[model samples]
Target: MRGLLTVCSAVLVTVLTVAGPVPAAKAAEPGGGDIGEALRHVPGLTVVDEAPAPDGYRFFRLTFTQPADHRDPDAGTFEQRFTLLHKDFSAPTVAYTSGYNVSAAPNRSEPTRIVGGNQLSMEYRYFTPSRPRQENWADQLTIWQAAADEHRAVQAFRALYPGKWLATGGSKGGMTATYFRRFFPHDVDGTIPYVAPNDVIDEIDSYNRFLSRVGDDPGCRTALKAIQRDTLKRRDEFGGLATADAAKKGYTFTTVGSLDKSLEIAVIDAYFAFWQYQKQSDCATVPKAGAPAAEVYAWFEKVESLTTYADQALAPYVPYYYQAAVQLGSPEAYDGYLRDLLRYPGADVPESFVPKSIERPPFDHFAMPDIDFWVRTQGRRLLFVYGSNDPWGAEPFRLGPGSRDSYRYFVPGGNHGANVAQLPPDEAAAATATIRRWAGLPPAGPEVTARSAPAGFPDFDADPIMTARPRL
Candidate 1:
């Protein structure tokens, strides 16, 4: 998924309780039939705290105790954190499956907003706030295990929210939702994976192919390369500038070797960022090879952060790199054109970024391929949204003959931020109608103004899964 930092940032609307008169206090116990008590009743579930929610919605921060290794109940247990946005008991429930950590704040997903239903926004297992006690990254963080964690959470919550259920997520979360549906076919009535990729391996070259022919303007592609070549041509100058800048900021680069190597990787990533996040209009800002040193350096930083490949920035995402190197395939760097200008040629592979402390087993080459095959053929009620221009959209999940009630829609010029609401009116209507129908809602969905990420969490650079590979 593109932006890991873009968690739901709806201003915490502080309130006393669920949007209703407080019921007489009965002993907080299961089977009491009260929704609040129903939440307390689910086995392995604990109420962490209540958070401010959108008006008419009650938000509860929750933790569900899950086995470290689902196959062995006796192995160990970890408390996986999640949030419940309650609207009504009879309303449909949207399982907002997260590909990474669940934010403490309550935010509405497109589906949840449009459907006006309850939401179960869950943090993926092995992520922050949900990690196991003993570090068993290699054995405990499989795709199947994460799906199992979601399944267990969903099963427990289904008891309280007996209405229809729909699963949805964007970027990596979208992939998580897909895996959830793949493993537990009937867990949710339908799934919408927005701008998710189905890369077949740890290091795929599809991105290189996509970037070569990405935008409508041939000039924009040429301009992107021009800036990359310009940055490297002045590596000595920019490298010194970056080094001093890093020192001033107190940034460290031990994780990715040295500041110079991080600079090289950041230069390579600028091209990916241009297409992954920037639009055609932004191409006007591309600096020429002969542009002033400050002008060129600033442009590079603007397109892609200089600290992107640094150890300090990468510490939060080591788990993502481990997963990518181990199972979830990731896009390799678009470094073919920059190889001649590159000082560190092979630093862009997925494995380079993983920490040395965590042991990575050989990539389970079949895991993702099997998932791709299953989602293509037998997956049902699956709706996929992609930005036509987003590089991650390059390896989108394809619907096959055996797939039933499935759809894949692309927002014409959408990037990683693409969504059903962004699709053309007809396409958006069709996609929303399908989701509404599957979730047992009325044919006409409500008008929802698209919500942006809360300030400080930009979707493009903050992506958790496919951030630029670190230099080794």
Candidate 2:
């Protein structure tokens, strides 16, 4: 799921303990019954304003522990949660900042529950920047930094909430987590940032190079190409179980097989920059203003299935054919096969190879693999978790220059958001049992199993399961 998180810059904020009266305490949230009654007894929890969310259900931000920003006074200020009173409590905080994943109605599950029983709060913030981020990506950075500073969200939990802990988020949110971990190492305890692509500029530039190299690597490339050919041969005879894009993402395609020969040339134009097509090279495809919409539509229809599995990978099958074709064909043939760069909405109109929101060009080839930069920082604590098969979870993360260690875990055979499915239902429950438990709408759901790391695949790039596990 796209993150219900964004870095809102223009929407200014500074969460002071702004109630009319600095209440010694507030009432427990209503409607939870036994669970609600049980929550009422949780020490330090005080019901604040009942904020309205979608579906007419209101979510009250309860206070467990009072929090304070350890950052410079001028740096910013954020009222802390009320749960930081425990003796061994590290009082961890999970800050989420996603690249493009934003959901107004967030899923009930959160990413941090892996370290079940730890003390912390989930800072459910959102930031959705306008398109054409190229113009304002820098300005947005300040906005992101300010948001973290103003909230002092990370610091409050670490200092106030008690117990060793960690902070984490996925994709864009993961990027935000990575940034926070690095920029304010002292504020957060530990960090598990997933699917965060740093080295943004280098990654984008490397996309073209990746394609070229894949084209050169005969064996691996050919493996994918052969799959593409076989799929093409069988596509007409049998109805497909998936879309063209899905096929590409999963390494499958119809005849003419993999576009390996042509893709290397085309992606250059497709991902060069925002709104602008490539120059110097003629591979960028665009539609003539007068072209019929049907013509363009048909192009998408033909290759649409190719992108179905984009989140997973470039269809390994077609690229397989691409490799074989390149190896078997003459240099002239290979060059001749390069895809044309004409009116690309190639049939691409509202859609194209890689979107601008992706921030960087495709870097499938020159993998700058994720490595753990787990630097135990001054005041950091962590609780990491993941499903064994989760691509995002498998990636390595950097704990920044001075970050702390993590309590990481992995669930075997689990897909993307599998951690929540474990014994402990969601984030609040985990927060509730925290040493100095916070008060809230009766910790929603059951105690969920914490997120964990996979056991094998040691060579995998970012999967920190191996890196953060107890080595003893």
Query: What are the RMSD figures for all models against the true structure?
Result: 8.9, 16.2
Residue 1 error, candidate 2, Å: 37
Lowest-sum lDDT 10-residue window in model 2: 1-10
Q: How many pairs of residues in model 1 come into backbone collision?
A: 6
The TM-score leader among the candidates is 1
- The top-ranked prediction according to lDDT is 1
lDDT of each: 0.75, 0.31
**Model 1 lowest lDDT segment of ten:** 4-13
What is the model-wide C-alpha lDDT for candidate 1? 0.75
Residues 235-327 of candidate 1: C-alpha lDDT, one tens digit per residue: 888888888888887888887788888888888888877777777788899987788988887887767876677777787677778888888
lDDT of 2 by residue, 1-472 (tens): 0011111111112322221112222232232223223335544455444434334222334443321222223222232222111112222333443322222222222433333223233332212221221222222123233335323534333323333444555543454555455444454445555434333222123323333332223443343333333333333321233343345455432322334312322222222121111121212233332344444323323323223323233322222122112211101112212233222223211112222342322222211111122222332444444443333332334345454333444444433333333423434345323311221113343433333322221211233321211100
